[model samples]
Target: MADAAFTQGAETADRGRLWVVLYLATTGLVLLLMMLAGLWMRLAQSGWLDTDPALFYQLMTVHGTGMVGIAALGGAAVLWHFLSAHIRLHAWVMGANFWLFLIGVVAILAADFPGRFGGAWTFLYPLPASSQGVWPVWAAALHLGGLLVIGVGFLIWCLELARGIIATYGGLGRGLGWHVLFGGSTKDVPPPTVVAATMVAIVTILALIAGATVLVMSLINLAFPSVELNPLLAKNLIYFFGHTFINATIYMGVIAVYELLPRITGRPWKTTKVFLAGWTLSTTMVLIIFPHHLLMDFAMPVWAMAIGQVFSYVNSFPVLVVTGLGALAILHRSGIRWDLVSTLLLISVFGWMAGVIPAVVDATVAVNSVMHNTLWVPGHFHFYLLLGLLPMIFAFMIHLVRVEDVTPRGGDLAAILYLLFGLTFVTMFLVGGWASVPRRWAEHLPEWQIWDQIAVITAAGVITLTTVFVAMFLARTPAMLAKG
Candidate 1:
């Protein structure tokens, strides 16, 4: 127990912290850019911006690509820190992983400018393959190539981590992670969650491989001109990749919760049991939920739909039960200190809860009918993304950095204001979604105009509140970086 802190190596913290700082700052830059694009999109639709769709798609494409690339796999670089610091693993391959990740991000961004690939990040076929006799098809190929390289980087880092665990557990009968969690000697290995993370990495590798294969084929067809595009195969491959990749971030978020939540409140999570079991559950169920994306398309059979919904409902249970509620349990047991990280964690729980209700209801055969493509879809995602993943990322950033970690003196007031702001976003999205308001629409029917106004007003509130918070953080960040 005395060595628990040291178990997370000292030098690794400094090294890992730099990566975290880069990741957090880059992610912030991406979000700031996205919000600007979103504002522009709003303006253009209202005829306020007078922008062309091509340029709009360029910004949107970069924004989506950047967020997904980092938000999803940023944790790949981060996993090195988790291993080296907490598990006392070697860092031989960490920097190498970062280099590859950077290469992929740079390549995709370069190809996305107006000349080569205005295909948008979705790369939604046929259009991406053709130029309208205007732009060449090579642009699509370039984007896929970038994703391929990033996937390779993720796999290499995972392998390095697994090897470290094997080294620590040479003769021990217990799992490596079990040894670490129970306060075993330096010779003992990491706990179950860490061990499960290796397996999650394996799943991510396969999903990406599947996606890259189909994407590459589509690109190759452009040159070959005779290759057939199988819609079924393409859809399956992309979702398999998309679902797993997005969930990868959630996996890291979950791990962070188990590791950091207890420490913040001076709580002990058995350091022994829940961490291992919870992650094991996550590894198993998460694989089955990918089919939910296909539910909107009717090409699949009823059995497929039923099975998808069932698994979709079931898959998130582990996360909702073990990580979400469990966080509060530990905090309740330990007494809440209400720090910035703690506040983010608390909000993550609420966000997860918010996502779960609509999601569970929509999973039902009856409700899925009304909620399938409407504003309800956005309703669920905002809660999931804004409340769940976004806050989770914020919590991770705080833990991963050294910015005083202080909430303002009036943070409780800030929390109330922020919560109301988020709720406004959720509420408007729900109203529009229920009214069958089509999303990504520039303007709507006269009846929908009121909902649109509500949406704009709420979104404006969110933008205002978020900008304030961001400015505060940015103000502090330069000083924090200066310290380093």
Candidate 2:
């Protein structure tokens, strides 16, 4: 433990540690808040009770912005410590980065409800471009400024990664840096986590900042509709950011799982190299392949769209197959008894694996055009975001608690029940998405009503699960709460 401590001072390093804690708490709060609100809105749509449609839009906007922010900043924070291991006073830099990230979160959350009441979290330029009537100019400015702040924080951290890799391995070249930093493996090859994290950061940040630039240009285009803000390019920007965010979730979650699963089961995951290479290839390809989502939008070139479809299919499915199955192969040979955390982790993987079929199929050129904006998008993503990413966060939290020997006071059974209800019902939405039922619509024609019904039911179940999980956390407060 002493050697594990770096040259950084106790106070500064502790601040960095606190930042990570705050980030997770903030992330969980935002996630639960968004899901719970969504569930409520769905319940109202189902005729149980009605909530304000205006407020519902706010919830949607907050959800998107919050989730993206969490994945980018919070996810990076998780990897930062590993990368910062050798940096002297990395704690101070980490602490500052964390605060800046939190500042961004607060700004976004604050801007969401009050700003024009636009429900779209991605902001989809030209809509939020104007601030005269619906929302004041100040609000839009605040949101953009907040995003810029967050982006800068991450940019600084990436520089840290680059510097740290050089210090450790004597030089930072291409391919991979994270695996090398995490473990002292020297090689011409880099590890999957390093490649994924750094690439996700690079791709998403550049795309988002470009989207921001387009946003500014879009303000001019608002007056000149013919001036085209590159809706196609804008859509690509979103895909670049959105896809990487989801992938980063999987990448970071895998890193934590790889580290902890070994300690828990007394068996390290096998074929680490295969899993690493698989992720490296997949992340690189996925970065360029997001144009696949635009196949249905006829404005784009047919050939480009075709390339997207091919790459998207290849990137989405195969990586998970090799890596996920490889993980199972490693786990299968392990003889140790499973615990609550291990169960949840494996279950999370199951949800991700199951979710991929619909996502992969939906990305097909034929299917995407039909199901592009439907409940299917939500259905497919809930698997990756909710079941895949959320469970990892839960499992990681539990790992922290258990390692510290914190008492299992609050959430023993409640967490399990929540997982059951949450996942079992979320699948219904995936089915609806598969059938081409549109999402975010309050009412649709008879053909779409069936899918809407399923979504509503699933959303309500999520609410109930959220309530249970919250209760469990509160219950365990006395036992788990402690100081570093």
Candidate 3:
């Protein structure tokens, strides 16, 4: 009987590991493809490639949508893998989400390539309908419909996670340690992973709902030309959804740090009042801070703009400080060994913290007036996503395949190269913004091409190193899965 039970447990573990492996593998492949597309765009802008302007916009649409979508999927895998240890999760829900995501990707690609839907991923209202005859109405509808499908899949994923957390912890509030924070209960305070997952589930659910509303509304207007939407309201909803959804990816990816860092340092990451407060504060602030994206809209109300600027300053600090300080406290004098995974995890914290500096600067209304439409916007996001969030995801992938914690030959070299080139790439964007270079233009002036040319070189380096990392993971995955 005992042997049978042991076998059953091992099988369950293998199944869970298999799902995670699938998720990471898909993420790595899609990420590489997206990076290549980005490289192509930079090359075109640099006059190194002679791509058509229409094709440039199409690739841009795919690059943006693919990167954001895959980030969320990868983050969900990390969260699910760790969070399952503490709660009961239905693995079928995860599998379903993956299939739905693939279907959505197919629809998006078809709409963009064959159908020529060049509207950006934001699908900002009326833009899809007013493609100036460049794209058909059906193409716009299909793209919007594809986004809705993706949002629905993510919504289901978050709901399942919420269900598991609630069942185990008694409620989302308890999962976030609201009871411990307010009721002063010393027993049963959830760990850092649970706290983070709870926050993600809450925010992602809300963000997806907002995204679905906007997508559906846009689809309706696409089919029926007479149905008009208030552009201001559409922008608000879209930014609220887009900003929150992307931000949640970082929050989800950070779970890898919370779960892995303690193991590396031989310490436990406990949930404290400070940690709970930080997450709770962030939950509120993240929802309201989306308005900062609309500060340039003169039609927007004064009160909303005030909320955007004021809360932008406040929101950047809480969870970051708690997580950053917590990691430091754990690593201090703990004699943690360094490896590719551990090194990347540490860099991720720094990247996230540093990324906030530029984001906060842009969030300020006065500074935003001049810099809102420049490469500075991309600079800020790429800093956090490339250096911060992607590192967390990559570290987790490397962690899964490692039989031991020792760094492989040249692992350190690869990591250092990634950081060096990533920093240079984003810095060029910041510099371009400083020089008032506009973003999202397929063609560049001769003077601006210098920056684009430099970025092309740095971006290639980053992509080559990332390819190495992903290749390593793919090669070792079979052995790791078999061991499970």
Q: How accurate is candidate 3 locally (lDDT)?
A: 0.91
- RMSD of each candidate? 4.7, 4.4, 1.6
Task: Give the lDDT ranking, best first.
Answer: 3, 1, 2
- Segments in model 1 whose C-alpha atoms lie over 4 Å from true places: 1-13, 45-51, 54-56, 73-80, 88-94, 116-120, 125-127, 130-135, 169-196, 271-278, 364-366, 399-406, 460-484
Which candidate leads in lDDT? 3
The sequence of per-residue lDDT tens digits that candidate 3 reaches over residues 433-453 is: 888888888998889889899
On TM-score, the candidate that comes out on top is 3
TM-score of 2: 0.83
The TM-scores, one per candidate, come to: 0.82, 0.83, 0.97
Report every candidate's CA lDDT: 0.64, 0.61, 0.91
The residue-by-residue lDDT of candidate 2 on 1-484, one tens digit each, is: 6654543355556666566555666666666777766666565555555556666666666666767667655465456533333333355556566778878777766676666445376666556665446666566666666766776676566566656555544554343443443454656444444444445545545555655565556445654657867667776665665565556556666555555566666765543555555655675676777776677778988777877878777886656776577567668768844555676677667777877777778778877878888778877777776776666666665555453444354444545665676665666666666666567765355665554566667666666655544444444433544634
Off by over 4 Å in 2: 1-13, 81-89, 130-137, 170-205, 208-212, 215-228, 270-273, 403-416, 444-484
Residue pairs that clash (backbone atoms under 3 angstroms), model 1: 8-85, 131-134, 176-190, 177-190, 177-191, 375-433
Ten-residue stretch with the least lDDT total in model 1: 171-180
Q: TM-score for model 3?
A: 0.97
Separately for all candidates shown, the number of backbone clashes (residues 3 or more apart, or on different chains) is 6, 4, 0
